[model samples]
Target: MDPENAASPPAGITREDLFERVWTTPINHLAEKLGMNHYQFARICEALNVPRPPAGYWQKKAVGKEAPRPELPAALPGDHARWSKGTRLLAPLPKRVYRRVERKAADRPQRPARHPMLIGVDESFRKTRTDEKNEFLRPYKYLLPDIVASADHLSTALDIANEIYNALDLKGHRVMFAPADQEMRRRHVDEQEVPRKDRKYGRYQTGSIWSPRRPTVTYVGSIPVGLVLTEMTERVTMRYLDGSYVREDSKLVRSARPWQLTHSWTTEQDLPCGRFRFVAYCPLANIEWSASWQETDAAGLKSLVPSIVARLHGSEAELQALIDAEEKAAAKRRKEWAEAQERYRRQEDRRAVEQALSHSKKQLAEIMEQWAAATAVERFFVEAEKRLEHLGEDRREHIQSRLALARAMLGEQDPLSYLADWLAPDERYQTRYPDH
Candidate 1:
């Protein structure tokens, strides 16, 4: 069948006929017969210019009252009375449902770490700056490049990273650089694909939605936990739609004003570096640990280490409990369903037995009625037997044959004996059926 014809209104039903049906039946009930939702059916009626009864129509009819249905307005010149077949109901697009994440309670105070990742790093600055591009740092090559940080920021970042690494390392975890492979990249909570040119930016390109990163991979045993980073200087961005640029010095600013005026432009100047923080996350466990981005300096980053460790263990326990509860509920539902099926089987068996007993009684009554009728005819022939001597031979033979047939119908014994058990009925009923 063509899809258009399937969805179109039934053929031969005019606009007036549709109006009568809508006013007579509830819209929801009518819509169901048409294989449509109430809203969709209403839209179809609107398109056809069909009028409907107002909301209280059914309630008024229930009380032996009438509700006035609206008069259908005239359709425009191109309007059609018959609905054209369109696509059947399309499923609604999926929506993301946000759920509140459960966090572990912060009840116990934790002890400070004894060994951090950066504990043995050399502190001396080199006369000529060199990139930290070795095999150990290879995974981070495209992401966190070895751009030289200011002497102070570098010291703070290193110290923060050391404390966070040690906190995990002491608990049988490892903090290493992220692997460059796609499989490892997918494990990061903030990982996403971007255009090729955006790959070198460490973050997704401007105008795209992505958070900043100072990439390092954390591991619990052999399992990779995604990007853990130490926060450095704060940068705020102002985005706009423009094809213009800005330069710094007074003369450069004056020169750029004309271009800015010609084309609306925006600027995103970095703010002064503030106290550093550290962020630790385990994407597999859906856990994130970080002190306030603005509040944590080198010392504060070390303090949060204990809390982060405690929460990781706590989250694992909670997740297990949730799984156990769901399994128990599923088992309970299965047990209840089995019990309901058993009850239905017993009820059906009882109904079959009751129906058989009722039918047996009806059969027995019909047999008894047939026997009584045959007995009445036999008595009539008994009286007429003496009078038959004076009759002709042919007439007497005809009367005798009918009397024999009446005797045969009554059978040799009491009617009840012949019908003692009707648990199973006879193979076939008599030619002349009993009324009941």
Candidate 2:
């Protein structure tokens, strides 16, 4: 047998061993030993089924010094050179690429905190005519509308006042309304306590018109807090003489006795008969009228009062219902939005897992391609060594030098030692390819 061909202990090697040895050495150092660029050596390491370490890892190890040449293992038989798809390897990755992947993974949304509450309020009203007639025998009318109209106006005003009150109350403040007239003030006093009254008695006024000697009655109405007062007045002129043609001045006749009815009195003054005043007194809180009340004027005022109250109640109820419905809708939308956010968070977690798996697979494929190419070059070195052993001593030295040159060109270490280096043990390689 040829001495060069003589069998040494066949290198005890497995694919896992080859992968670990090749993977453990830093790529830059391996490149220096093979007289190749770092990237070129990286391709060789990849062919040997080694995964790349991050670039920073090698750079730190080099510490600004020239990278050292890596040692190769002893040669093994061709049979020991088997490669498998599942072979594990360590490969060096570019620092930029690794950082980019890490950043992408971290760019997801985080959970959110709670927010504050939102609220709103609004008001509305309508007008209507009253049934009573005025002193001129014409239908009694409001400057705008009648009792229902006043009630509608009052209801709208109260609604607005209530909204302001609610807002102030939330902020620890108070609100109150005083009436424009006595009837409204009376109503207000009846609704609230004496201490709760916004204004003093006799501060507001109520007025009515009627035919002389006609029976009249007035109704005392209730008032609410926060009422704003405004003034109103009317005047009329009566002409008893005519001056159309002759410009004549007419004289009025004077009666010898202008008879006026008077109530009788005995030893002590007696009360007026069949004529009485109806006064509504509230002990809880007193209400003052700007104008005095007469017994003959009561009937007309009393007749209009109930309509005003009814209109106010209806309008208020409707407005309150509208506000309630709006609030309910707003609350419902908030709840739904919260649920949607939770679902979105869960979806993001699932996507992260899938992305990680895909990234790992892509990295593995790149390492495998590099390792396959390096293996082919190593086999060529093994063949050349066999042919070199057959030459004469002088020619053998020449051939050996040529073989050395060839190894350098192929970026290989000693063929025998390189094979042994490819079969070293590595824990990381074993873990990634446990089944192998």
Q: Compare the candidates by lDDT and give the number of the best one.
A: 1
Across residues 1-436, which tens digit of lDDT does each residue of candidate 1 receive? 3222233354634566667777777778767766779998786666556877777778888997866667878753223456534522212212323456566568854533323333323243222233321101112223331222334355555555556566666676555444322133322322111113222222222222122133455554344444344233333342332432332333545555465546554454332243443334433333333222223334465566677666553444454454456568768878989999866766665565556666777877787786687567556766878778888999999988876786688555455555664545333222122322
**lDDT per model vs. reference:** 0.48, 0.33
Candidates in order, TM-scores: namely: 0.28, 0.24
Candidate 1 C-alpha RMSD relative to the actual structure:
30.9
Can you tell me which runs of candidate 1 are displaced by over 4 Å? 1-152, 177-182, 186-215, 219-224, 232-267, 284-299, 318-436
| Residue pairs of candidate 1 with colliding backbone atoms | none
Give the alpha carbon lDDT tens digit for every residue of 244-279 in model 2: 111112122121122311221112111111212112
* Alpha-carbon shift of residue 95 in model 1 (angstroms): 50
